[model samples]
Target: MNLVTPPEHPFAQFVRILGKGKRGARNLSREEARDAMGMLLDGKVEESQLGAFLMLLRHKEESAEEMAGFTEAVRARLQTPAIAVDLDWPSYAGKKRHLPWFLLAAKALANSGVRILLHGGGAHTAGRLYSEQLLETLDIRLCRDWQQVEKALDQQQLAFIPLGDWMPPLQHMIDLRNILGLRSPIHSLARILNPLNARCGLQSIFHPGYQAVHREASQLLGDTAVVIKGEGGEIEINPDASSHLYGTANGVNWDEEWPALAAMRHVKPASLIPEHLLACWRGEASDAYGQLAIISTMALALRGLGEPRDTAINRAEALWASRHQVART
Candidate 1:
């Protein structure tokens, strides 16, 4: 296969370079990865070729430089809304067993004067579903257009952008992973991709193994991101008082169980599933999980946005109390 021919277009060139690889995995140089990603975001690569490139990248695994380069390429294609605060939260893409709290976290942060943007979908084959479904239950509509996303932030200080709506090609790449019956490199890359020039970000991680990757990538990217090993990959700390909750920014770090704040008590766990939780929100049924999700997520959001430990605990208690009364009535 010829790797040096200049095709008629950048995308075609990308297809030629990436398609030259065999069916199995292959390591990619930083330049190759960047060129391929640039072609992808520029709409230069054909759909089939793009799918092949993604699969190849998955089997090979992405290095920090490659991931960073790919992220830059993707961001160039994004139409970011002009919000007062450049806040971002990347959902880790798999959360079926436990309840989702990121939606609640976004809402609570928005309520407390923080500008927030959340991105995710509902096509997890193994997991129960994504966070998009939970937001729908809260009456928060997904913004389809980048302009509308900006407008939502300008007007309401909160916006949710489904990957399908914001970037179809990238979503197509993610969908291809489903064909393999497991997650692909895109899954990990998506968690670290911050499209907007957001100075503050709340990033969630699923497995502990990815902590070094996230930390290294965040450091290299030099963004102010708080990495959380939240519940089921959502940005909520475990309420058992046993799990260690950590947040890091600019080399400074803090945890919920630090010696300075060891007096905090664990919140009670919720017992309902995602669908039933929504029903409970609508007053059509009772959902312990929904209520717990709201409380725990709100607390974590407060902490993520720089709220003092005591204040976060107090705010969570107050919000839970208010919601409980409403549910009773």
Candidate 2:
């Protein structure tokens, strides 16, 4: 007796399109990628197909078109409000070696009237200190939805939203790190989401070659963004070493080198202390490395927002110096 072949699952086509033999496989077109991501976000894809699709894409590193397409699908479903956001800061990569000095930098900028939205996936990886956990200590509000986001941004010029709250599907994928034994493209896609369409998007990559990918992807998405190899992959500029900034603005792509803020490399702190961030901001602590990290990271964001190099650095320094006064007012 002969058996009839069953019809293929609709989502299986996407998995096949990506996982076909080396000779047959190819990157998906922007339209295909957008459709695939839409299905994933809508929970239409099955578990087996979902794993295969993501891992196949991961094996062959996602392209700018893929990233841009994925970002489009995500933004389409996002319920972003009309609130004007100056900076889109995604902090998915939790810090391990250093306290999240960038948080302090963001607080200073927010205090000085720069409306910023910081979103992150909860700490999926072990032994890292994520932004969401430390927000209370820093006195920044952790918002759960657009309503809270709008209120926080209006009240304090800053808001921190976790991925699980805004986009549960992406956060689910991030949490699958242990099961998959490798990170999916969701990590990179999350960084470029910029759900609020902020004028300036800040992205960081731990791996090399992704900077260019992020730059091209941001250009494709028509985003003014800066891509950096942040310290511990958290967008915090390391004071001990020179760093390169790859970015796009007004549809133009550019790169620049920033000198080390410290004369010599400083050893990593013995431990990451959460309270130190607030203490530094309150002018109760003096940490040369931490202070320089905050100013340099702020300057990078300011430059991404169209400030001149020297002027951005000067402005960041001034912002840090007067953070207490900004808070009081």
| Per-residue lDDT over 1-329 for candidate 2, one digit per residue giving the tens place of the 0 to 100 score | 99999998888888888888999999998899999999999999988888888899999899999999999999999877797999999998899998999999999999998999999998789999999889889999998889999999888999998989989999998888899999899998999999999999999998999999999999999999999999998889998998999989899999999999898888889998898888887888888899999999999989989998899999999998888666532
Q: What are the per-model numbers of colliding residue pairs?
A: 2, 0
TM-scores for the candidates: 0.74, 0.97
Q: Stretches of candidate 1 above 4 Å error?
A: 1-32, 46-52, 92-94, 241-248, 251-293, 308-311, 319-329
Best by lDDT: 2
> Clash number for model 1?
2
Lowest-scoring 10 consecutive residues by lDDT in candidate 1? 320-329
Candidate 2: lDDT of 260? 92
Off by over 4 Å in 2: 327-329
lDDT of 2: 0.91
